[model samples]
Target chain A: MSVTDELLANNAEYAASFTGPLPLPPAKHVAVLACMDARLNVYGVLGLEEGDAHVIRNAGGVVTEDEIRSLAISQRLLGTTEIILIHHTDCGMLTFTDDEFRTSIRRDTGVKPAWSSEAFPDVEDDVRQSLARIRTSPFIPHRDSVRGFVFDVATGKLNEVR
Target chain B: MSVTDELLANNAEYAASFTGPLPLPPAKHVAVLACMDARLNVYGVLGLEEGDAHVIRNAGGVVTEDEIRSLAISQRLLGTTEIILIHHTDCGMLTFTDDEFRTSIRRDTGVKPAWSSEAFPDVEDDVRQSLARIRTSPFIPHRDSVRGFVFDVATGKLNEVR
Candidate 1:
């Protein structure tokens, strides 16, 4: 089957696991900004249900312009009041330098000027930096409560990094 | 020091790493729905950068009404053309039965009239099941491409399970 067909199959079984209709709280909602790593299981860690939280993720769980836009929507429009930022140890962002990543992309895509030194660079600093940017961003409701944590990919533990 | 102070210190250092401005690409954007588990790193696996993708996540990385809402917005406004569902091995989604989770939340939150059974549930099937849901979701854009993968938390590797 094609990739699309496969995705449908997986989602079907996943959906079937939910025997009942789990919904989110309408009044007090939470938003999570986390890395795209597979190791940090936010639901299991937080003891959450299917619709309990709003999670936004990216590499290193960093805050970007789009992330800010989404955060603003979640807080101002969607009723999300608390924000959790989760970074992790042994991140791939720590593995390579920006120059290295650009080189790899150039070789793979065969595109001249593939990405600048700043494009894919700066993974290691994304976590703490992203938290600050999100916390202070005027776009996000200033009153929202924001916290940051570091999830250990190897240990499956979360520590309050902020 | 206060959490705010820490956030500022780390973020300032983090922001200094961005030495150059990067350009945005016009390629079709992809949305990755995955688990919040700390074991998997989506960036290194996908080789992504800032402004490249949208990641919506939950406990098992399972799709729910809210996740769908986010997906709806992501596709309707954010120019996303694809969805990638990633589930992983040794997930907590498979650890506790639904009864256990409901009981725990009830005891802790003191909010009875237990919510839907779909809250935090088990992940029984493999990658194929997750893939099927994404492909068949009526709400997902028909033109969008969707795929599924299972990441091994222990090995830090991913196999296209679907």
Candidate 2:
């Protein structure tokens, strides 16, 4: 079976004991934007249960127009007020640069992507960049509690970036 | 204390027992794009552990340019092959129209967003839409195993969107 099939089988087991249909709005009124790193389980890291917070993630956990869009909807429509941003050590985005990645894609696909690859040399700097993007975006109304962090891979500890 | 602080305390407990520093690439060779809904716990639902799959999420779980960017990096740089698109039942995206959302934002912020809100009336249709977005993208290398599903909030089951 494909790994997808294996996960589907796992889902059957998950559904058997599940009782949900939680309230529409997050009980904690928070949203988290984190990297799409396979190792960083946002729910576990935050001790989140169902109906707790809106979890938004991407390649570098970097803020793009899309992330701002997600955060605007999350805060405006869903009532989440606080925001948390997470980037982690040993991320794939750190391995390459925007120019090299785009050029490689261009050579392979014959159509170069116009978008920025959003790769970063430093994780904390990017986390601060994400925080700044959210703060500067006029779309997101709640900015008081916006914070950023870098998750240590080996220790699994989140260190806040001031 | 803020909810962010409470979550930070939780992170401490998570760190206490955490044993990680897993390999950077996903072990299961799949990427899951799902809604950022608070109730849909992608890890628990899929029985995924750390390092299993790349979980990418947004407000609607809809594919846009950023998703295309992320998928290109995932396939080209990280080696994930299969794609899973998940849109859950009773998602916040269905509660408002794009025009309504943009108009409300314009009223509040004095500026309108150029991006689409990506709201849809039907969950399965949006799942299909997300699937199509990935299938048609020339940037994403693998499309053969791309699948979409609507996760049932009440039953905790993922119903395939065929």
Candidate 3:
């Protein structure tokens, strides 16, 4: 079986014991923007149960137009008032640069990407940058509790980026 | 304490038993795109362990330029070969049209959002739409095992979007 099939089998088991159809809005009234890193399981890290908070993720957990769009909808429609941002150590994004990645993709695919790869030299700086993006945005209504953290991959601890 | 502080407390417990850093690349060689719904815990739904797969999420699990950027980075930089697309039942995306959402944001903020809100009328159709996005994109290298599904929120079951 393909790995997809294996995961599907796992899903069958998950669904069997699943108790869901929770209310539409997040119970905790928070939204989390985190890296798409396989290791940073947002649910586990935050001790969140199902239906707790909106979790938005991307390549570097960097804020972009798309992320702003997600956050706007999250708070405006869903009523999430707090935001948590998580970036981690040993990130693949730290391994490359935007110019290098865009150049490589152009050479391989003949189409240069217009978007910034959002590769950052420093994780904490990027976290602060992401926080700024949310705080200054007019679309997002709530910015009172926006916080950023750099999670230690080795220890799984979140150190606030203050 | 605020909810963020509460989650920080949870993180202390998580880190107490936390193990050392895993490798940068996903061990499962898979990438999952799903909605930013709180109820659809991607890890629990797919029985995914940390470091198993890359999880990208947004408002609708819809494919956009940023998602294309993420998938490219995942397939090219990392070694993930398979892609899974997940949209769920009773999705907030189905509640409004893109035009309506855009208009509301424009009226509220006095500036129109250039990005599409990506609201869809149907869930399964949107799943197929997201799947076709990956299949047709030239940037993503490995598209052999791309699949799409709709998690039935009421049943906690994932129904494959055929």
Instruction: TM-score chain B for all models.
Output: 0.79, 0.98, 0.98
Give the per-residue lDDT digits (tens) of candidate 3, residues B118-141.
999999999998988889998999
C-alpha RMSD between model 3 and the true structure = 0.8
Off by over 4 Å in 1: A1-162, B1-8, B19-28, B113-129
Q: Give one digit per residue, the lDDT tens place, for model 2 in B41-134.
A: 9999999999999999998899999999888889999999999899999899998999999999999999999999998999999898899889
Residue-level lDDT of model 1, residues A116-157, one tens digit each, is: 222224333565677778766655654546777776544444
lDDT (10s digit) by residue, model 3, range A2-85: 889999999999989988789989999999999999999999999999999999999999899999999999998999999999
In candidate 1, residue B62 scores what lDDT? 63
How accurate locally is residue B98 in candidate 3, as Cα lDDT from 0 to 100? 86
Error of 1 at B139 (Å): 2.5
lDDT of 3: 0.93
Kindly report which residue pairs in candidate 2 clash with one another.
none
- lDDT per residue for candidate 1 within B1-162, as digits (tens), equals 533343335444443443322222213366777765443444434544444566666556665545554564455434577777787776645655556644654565454323332323334354455566656655456444666677655444455653
lDDT of 1 at A44: 42
**Positional deviation of B151 in candidate 2, in angstroms?**
0.1
lDDT of each: 0.53, 0.94, 0.93
Candidate 2, residues A11-66: lDDT per residue as tens digits?
Answer: 99999999987898999999999999999999999999989999999999999999
Q: Which has the higher lDDT value, candidate number 1 or candidate number 2?
A: 2
lDDT for A74 (candidate 1): 56
| TM-score for each of the candidates | 0.49, 0.99, 0.99
The interface RMSD for candidate 2 is: 0.6
Error of 2 at A61 (Å): 0.3
